[model samples]
Target chain A: MKDKFGLQRIRLSVQILYTILTNGYVYGYMQGKIYKGGLKYACVPGLNCYSCPGATFSCPLGALQSALNQRQIQVPFAVLGFFFLFGSIFGRFVCGWLCPFGLFQDLLHRIPLFQKRKQLPGHRMLKYGKYLVLAGLVLVGSSFLFDGFVKVPAFCKYLCPSGTLMGALPLLSVNEQLRSQVGGLFGWKLGLLLVLVGLSVKVYRPFCQYLCPLGAIYGWFNRFSLVQIHWEQEACISCGACQKACPVDLKPEQISVSTECMKCGKCMTACPVQCLHWRKIEKN
Target chain B: MSFWHKTLDKRPKRGMWFLLFGIGVVCLVIGIYEGQLEDVYRKAVMICLECIGIG
Candidate 1:
């Protein structure tokens, strides 16, 4: 019997590489410094927390929003272009392979804690939540003020579990003064992180599937991205093997560069006939 | 079925993507010239209190 259900060793390696690459400042906690190197000026194409003590680069989503928030700039071409460039190149492959938060969820789901739901209830409706986050919280909220004093970036300020987990949690852990400063806001953020973590054990990256606006941004470019998965329709037997293999339960053929797919290559690995292949561009 | 095929077949040329990439490079350079890189460095060094909703 073939070891068809074997562990994804290469995928794990890729995930770890990105996690360390994005957050490589090992002395940040000991020295109490966020490294302000030239690399810090660039946007990492993943949902890494910008304020993570060890983070060497700013997160693309956070940098984009921060650039927009500056009233002085009419257009933040550097941040915008980085987003466009990465999106057109890799699409949601970053979510599947690079995002530290996605890796965290993948690890959490590996635990034999409980039987997991392969799909969410009202998932079609829930999928829209990330776009809502992109529009209402990240974009509109950052560009405008909620009240006279309050800053409006609702997703990062109120909802981003990655920011809470990687940023606030680490800061609070090392600094006694920071812990003392923690109040209702800290508790609320912690609660959100807990809920998302809990759901991830069952739902295979609930945050990416539902709430990550960064993933949403990348998903938009998945269809036309340089890196794409193409199905050999002629070779397909329609045996539904790939469909069963999908963690998110999407059909293999339709999953090719689709918004919902993370391009994890599960279908390719699972296909009995070996139909799906990753390509830089489709050969027409 | 016909709609899916039509929409799926509509693809931009490889050269067009290369052109877009060049344009994107130009935008990135312009943004850095406009001091966005400096802004990123400034933001990176300091922990964002607002992002964590600490203050």
Candidate 2:
């Protein structure tokens, strides 16, 4: 139990440290300005809003959508490369440990007021929603949709609660010029953010499970990523403790490399016999 | 098992990951050459009204 507690503390520490490092532009927040620096050329491997005042790196999802929204309609090679690089190395581990929005959801879930549920109703079907968000909104919508002369980053514009909470709220609070421009769209986004916040208090990572396109992209690489959770079948007792411990309620033994597995190491700590362990791909 | 069978085992190999990583690096280089990094920087430095749900 002490080991489990220590592991969770380590994960939380990493999450906090990563968040602070990525969003290190303290002056931006003070001055209500985005960071204009060389670091913005590279994308971060998390769902942090690029518009957030403190964010020093570009968001991969926002960059991909922006690239796709160009009038010439070309493949976003840089964003794809970023995804490939991060996805191949860390996979959905980014979602589990690096994403600022994910950390926000985790903190919200820790609020003791609500009765926590491991899985939402219709979790099996709902889990596929993130993929749809990636395909239909980020990919297709950005590639084609135009609002008059301007192209829309459909997911970021319409659905990203992270943008509303982290980018919109903070910027608006500090910038009087921005506050004057607040309209129905901001209200709608705030409402959506509230719903997600309420849901997060009861359910674990509602955005990650059903809506985050970035999570969807990283999830595809989980099975093939260098970092992986290996299950030793021979040493297994069919004890269901790991499943109970899983934040997403995944059966770790049955599908060790399931795309849904975020590599959070909860199950590793939960296993009584220590059958599950983190392993890198073997050199042939 | 034959060499092919051994190579094609279910377990993920480091070689495959390295190849993918190489491909990612190549893609990143191509993108930088094409000025996509500048585009990313330009977009990131600006306050995105759409992201903030304004206008």
Candidate 3:
């Protein structure tokens, strides 16, 4: 059996389309569209701007972060429920396919001439970075690191390449008056973007691989998450084709969620043994 | 396939790193010199919040 799952490719394309739509909205493509009840709904599985020129719903992460910052009640409930619903059904498939930010990273990595490098050369614990980031964001945002409520959403403040590439650049281009008022925070974010872009050329997706809090949340449910990639280890001829086919460098035959696996299904497509399959688990 | 196409398609040339690095530095300098960093940050935050449905 050879790799048959083209889901990753399909997902990647869909993500790219979402990014284009979001970016286009920010860049002034569609200006005056009207929504009835003040367009404040959320995308089911991934990040898409509600205020985005063409966005139809709310952004889940933004809502969660704001709730955390404001100390709201139902916000946590909303976040938890959203995670459970998506986690049970799609698992980390959200990271692989649906996330607009993930798409941005994928596109940036496609830029030729950069040698994507591995930030984690130590033990393979690097996969935990996103979880750590999630924790850091919630903890820091709700409570000051050491002092007051000065903690910004650290992920958006420092690490999110999506914010830098999709939202920041286009918005600045259109709002020239806004561009005239730059400072240290902007400098820091630009520096971060530069590093991310450079690293993307060297690594497949440095941000997703290392720092995305959203990816971390989804990845937590990867193993038993309703949408799962299963391997019939018994049908094993360890040809390592799936291993090589993996863009995120996961050895699909061995482990599933090592932070390296984007669940892109490149392994599923490249598996000559055709042992990989996706199935839904019913809660009984 | 033509040699150029083949070359262009395989992966970026090593020197592309230096070129990107140079461009990044220039942008950094220009952005700093022009003193538009805070504006950029605020804009980034507002837009990011909007994109994700926060704003």
Best to worst by TM-score, what's the order?
Answer: 2, 1, 3
Under CAPRI classification, how is model 1 graded?
A: medium
Give candidate 1's error at residue A231 in angstroms: 0.3
TM of each candidate vs. truth: 0.93, 0.95, 0.71
Global lDDT of model 1: 0.79
DockQ of each: 0.58, 0.50, 0.02
- Look at candidate 3 and tell me the lDDT of residue B32: 42
Query: Where does candidate 1 clash, by residue pair?
Result: none
Per-residue lDDT, model 3, residue A32, is 29
Which parts of model 1 have CA positions greater than 4 angstroms off? A1-7, A146-152, B2-6, B11-16
Which candidate tops DockQ?
A: 1
Task: List the global CA lDDT of all models.
Answer: 0.79, 0.86, 0.55
For candidate 2, write residues A1-284 as lDDT tens digits. 44654788899999999999988788988988888888899998998788999998899999999999898978788888999999999989998889999999999999997789977899889989999999999999988888899889999999999899779988998999999999998989999999999999999999998888888888877767888888776787969888888988877543436677788888888889988888886777
Instruction: Tell me which of candidates 1 and 2 scores higher on TM-score.
Output: 2
- The model with the greater DockQ, 1 or 2, is 1
